[model samples]
Target chain A: MKANKVLINTLAIAITFMTLVPFVWMVSASFMHQGEANQFPPRLFPETFSLEHYLRLFISMNIVRYFLNSVLLSASITGLSLLVNSMAGFAFAKFHFPGKESLFKLLLAAMIIPAQVTMLPLFLMMNQLGLINSYFGVIIPGMASIFGIFLIRQYISSLPDSLIEAARLDGATDFQIYWRIVLPLAKPILVTLGLFTFMGTWNDFMWPLIIMTRESMYTLPVAMANLSGEHSQDTELMMAGAVITVLPVIIVFLALQRFYIEGIMLGSVKE
Target chain B: MKGKRLFKVWMSPALFLAPALLLIAVFFFIPVVVSFLMSFTDFDIYSLADSSNARFVGLENYKNLLSDPLFWKAMHNTLYFVFIGVPLSLFVSLGTALLLNSKLIRFMSLFRLAYFLPVVTTLVAVAVVWRYIYHPSFGLVNYLLSLIGVSGVDWLGNPNWAMPALILMAVWKNFGYNMIIFIAGLQNIPPELYESAQIDGAGRWQELLHITIPMLMPTTIFVSIITIIGYFQLFAEPYVMTQGGPMNATLSIVLLMYQEGFRWWRMGYSAALAFVLFLILFAATLIQLHLQKRFSTV
Candidate 1:
């Protein structure tokens, strides 16, 4: 029995190392000088740590522009999506309307249809609208989503309706009730959904790859992909790029892990 | 005053819902129909310039895709991924969840963070990092293997090892997600069931087999379905790491569609590929649901 306990603990330690080694190596390798990572024995740590590649990334690569673009896009998509999806989610939760059930059912059914099916024609439509190679091409499609509405609606429905009713009896406009009461009360779910949207938009690769054709407009992920193609030989340089692209989302995730993990449970249970 | 209130009540939902509804209609629903229509026509670069140039070649793209060797290889590779990757991921996820759930382990949060850190990071960035990790001679994986007397294997360079390399990386990236779900499911299982099993003198292994596995069925089904659907669309990893291979070993269905539509401008074929992906997922979900209904006495 004692041996079994030791065995289990050792297993945990081993798997944890296996899980974390790549990230540790990436960070370590990013600090290594050029040609240093190709050591025969495979150095796990940089012997002489340097910031030269990071300097090159900033001065020569203009990665700051891509970084700003990613931040700008993620924040906008989160804010807009929160507003649009919440309004719709609020209506479904508190208000009655004709065709509401069928409409929601239709929306739910549409979830099963993969977004890839829509991309080809969606690209054509973007071209027709002259939104191609523009941030709006990415933003407009993401401004509202079915899953976002469904998530917000589920949470909002669980809140007591008496609050909205009292606000209404006191002559509060529906918008006022939504903006004032529902918004504050629904803050947790909003944070959860907002984190989801922010992280999703930050890490998204394919749509940005399609829409943002201009080098100046590329998100961090798209820019990194482009770099990997051209600078495939520069291990240290590419590792620095990966660290830059990955570090922000990691910080966000760790900072807001409670809300993020809450979102995960809600996703599983709510669905 | 009452009339005004009634008017506001009636018009409010319309105002609240219209913008989102309109956007979804234009961007999502209409585009789905447009793609379906385009799949019937021979839409290429020519038609992309002028609508009149597209020939309504009914079912031709689907017929051609059905017989195309590359499409079949992609289909086979995708199925191979789904079949092997889904269960392997679940196994790892459940293993980690069980380990983390054990009372013997401390620092559960730290362990969880380590496991899940890969999941939230950008896939392209990690794929790039993993590309170097799978390097022929200087890689950590090869070096570690050498210690155990297994000589270096060309991971990304060999067709046989390429898909498995991508799968291992994918599994590493993904298992933490399902692990979280499984942990939740494990916690929700009634402690009374375990207590009763122990009172009946059941050993740990027997209790786990009879009680834990049986109780976790619904969660297992949910995780597997989502995992299958998500794994079916494998693009970014192979794109960043192998570029669909040392010889097309890692080319997936969506990757093929991306190449056909984006690279070659063959919109009709790509649209058809999209529909086919949708059909496959629908069939997969239905099969899972049917199996659930058949076996689930609860």
Candidate 2:
């Protein structure tokens, strides 16, 4: 029994180390000076760490611009989506409009259709709207997603109806009730949904690759891809770029981890 | 009061649904419909200049797609990815979930974060990172393999290994998501059942086999279906890394659709490919639903 316990403990430790090693190695390699990473016997610790590549990325490559773009785009998408989807979610949860169930059912069915199917014509539509290569192009398609609405509605539905009724009885307008009452109560899921939207927008690659034509409009992911294409040989610099692109998301996830993990379970449990 | 009540009722839903419905219709639904229309017509470079140039070909693009060996190759490659990648990912996720949920495990959050790190990382960045990591000589993977006395294998350069390499990276990136879901399911399992099994003199293996697996069926189904849907939409990894090459071994349906739509300006043909993919996906979704229903009833 003692031997079995020892074996299980060792197995657990080994698995944890294996899971963490890639990320640890990535961070370690990012900090190492050029060519120091590819050393024989694989130095897990940097003999000489430097911020030269990071400085070069900011100075030479305009990586900060891409970072700003990711931030701006992700924030805009989140803020707008929260407003839009929260309203819709509130309605779906509380309001008894005709065809509410059918409208929602249709949206749920539409979820099965992959976003890629719409890419071709969405590109054309954006081009026609003079939105191509603009932030609006990327932001517009993602402004309101069915999943976002569904998530918000699920959370909103669980809230007691008597609260909203009380607001209505006290002469709060429908919008006022949503903003003042439901919104405050639904804050947790809103944060969860916002983080989800923000992370998704930040990490998105395909649509941005399609919509944003010029180098100037590129998000961090797109810029990283472009950088890899151009500077495939500069492994250290590329690692630095990867580090920059991935770091914000990791930080965000770590900071709001409780909400994020709960959000995942919530989303998965229903559908 | 009635007027105010009616206005409140109509306005709330309208205000709420309008934005999402509008965006979904304009950006998602309309474009999908437009793509369906586009698949039937000869929409190409000339059509971009003048819409009049696009003629209704009436399934010519579909016919051409059927005959195209490149499309077949892409289809074969995609199926290979779906079939192999789906089961492998499921197994890995289930394995990790089992390990993580084990009573002997400590520092669960630390391990969970480590496993899930790849899921949240930017795909382009990871692909770029993995491109180097799959580097035959300098790669971490090869370096580790060499410790076991195995020679370095050209992971990306070799056509045979290229898709498998992509599958490996993809699995590594994605398995954590399903693992989390499975962990939730595992945790949800009633502890009393396990205790009951223990009192019945059931061994660890028997308890897991009889108790855990049966309980996890619904979650397993959900994970597999979503994983399959996601695997079919493989685009960014190959786009960033291989551009669907060493002889199109890694070329996927979406990548092929992308080339035909954007790169070559064969929009109509690409639209056709998109519909066919949609059809295949629809079928897969139905199968998943069917399986779930069957399992539930049984």
Candidate 3:
């Protein structure tokens, strides 16, 4: 039994180290000087920790612009999606209307259709709307997702209907009840959905790559992809760009991981 | 009075649902419908410049797709990925879950988080990182291989190795997600079964075969279906790391569609390819569900 325990522990630790190697290498290489990351034996830690790559990324490559673009785009998508999805979710959970069940079912079934199917037409639509190369091109489609609505609706459905009824008895308008009562009660889910949206928008590549034609309009992922293409040989510089692109999502994920995991569990368990 | 009350009840929900429904209708539903229609027409770069240039080419694109060797190649690659990648991913996930769920393990959550870290990171960023890691001469992978007295192999540059390299990165990136699901599944299994099996002189492997595997079947199915669907849409890894390169060894259906639709502006043909992908996914999902039902009945 003792020998078995030792074996399990050893395996666990070994797997954990292997799992973390890429991230550790990414961080270490990002701090290495130009040409230093390409050295013989592939140093796990920089010989001299330096921010030269990050400095070059900021000053020469103007990654700050892409950074800010990512922030703006992700934030807008998160905030707007929260409001739009939450309102619909609340209605689906609380309000009664003709065809509500069928409508919800239709939306649920639509999830099977891959987003790639819509890309070509959506791009043409955006072109017609003069939204091509604009933040709205990305933000608009992201404003309301069926999955977000489903998540919020699932959460809100568990909340006591009497609360909404009580607010209704207090002469609150539907919107007011949703804004003043339901929104506050739904904070945990809102945060979960918000993190999901923010990270998704931030890390999104294909759509942003398609929509944002201009270099200035590029999100972090698209910008990073472009950098990889243009500077494939600059290992340190690419690592720096990778770090910048991935850092915010990681921070957000680590901080709000409780809700995120809860959200995943909630999603997996059929309602 | 009754009519007014009915109107009020309907209006409230409608008002709340309007924005989301409208957005979904316009941005999602309409585009899907339009893309379906567009697939029947010869919508190309010329059509982009002038809408009138597009002509109704009934099923020609699909017919051409049938004959296109590249399409077949992409189909083969995608099936290769889905078939091999799904089982490998499930095995890794199930293995990790079993290990992590072991009572003897310490700091399980920390280990879980470490394994899951890749799942949360941006794929494009990780792909770029992996690109460097696959570097032949100066890469960490080759360097480690050298320490083992194995000669450096060109990971991404060799067509034989490129797909496998992508598969490795993908398995590394994704196993944690299904691990979490499998962990949940494992926890749900009644411990009395294991104890009963032990009392019956059943060994560890026998207990796993009889109890754990059967119990975890639903979760396994769920994970497999989702993994298959996700893998079918393989794009970012190839786009970022190899660009379907080393002589198109890593070319995926979605990448081909992207190249055709966006890069070359062959909209109709790309839409046909997209529909074919959708068909494959739909069929695969149906077959899985059918198998699930069969298993449940048996």
Which pairs of residues have clashing backbones in candidate 3?
none
Give the candidate order by descending lDDT. Answer: 3, 1, 2
**Candidate 1 lDDT for residue B169:** 95
The sequence of per-residue lDDT tens digits that candidate 3 reaches over residues B105-170 is 999989999888898999999999999999998998999999999998899999999999999999
**Which one wins by DockQ: 1 or 2?**
1
Please list the residue runs of candidate 3 whose C-alpha ends up more than 4 Å from where it truly belongs after superposition.
Answer: B295-298
Candidate 1 chain B: minimum summed lDDT over ten consecutive residues — where?
Answer: B289-298
Give candidate 2 misplaced runs (Cα > 4 Å). A38-42, B1-8
Interface RMSD of 3: 0.9
Identify the superior model by lDDT, candidate 1 or candidate 2: 1
Q: Poorest 10 consecutive residues of model 1 chain A by lDDT? A: A1-10
What number of backbone clashes does candidate 2 have, counting pairs of residues 3 or more apart or in separate chains?
0
Model 3 CA lDDT for position B244: 94
> Per-residue CA lDDT of candidate 3, range A57-144, in tens?
8898879999999999999999999999999999999988889999999998888899999999999999989999999999999899
Candidate 1 CAPRI level: medium
**What tens-digit string does per-residue lDDT give for candidate 1 at A1-271?**
6777787778888998988889999999999999898777899999999999999999999899999999999999999999999999999988986678998999987887888899999999999999988889999999989999999999999999899899989999888999999999999999999999999999999999988989999999999999999999899999999999999999999999999898999988734
Q: Each candidate's interface RMSD, rounded to one decimal?
A: 1.2, 1.6, 0.9
What lDDT is reached at residue A16 by model 2? Answer: 66
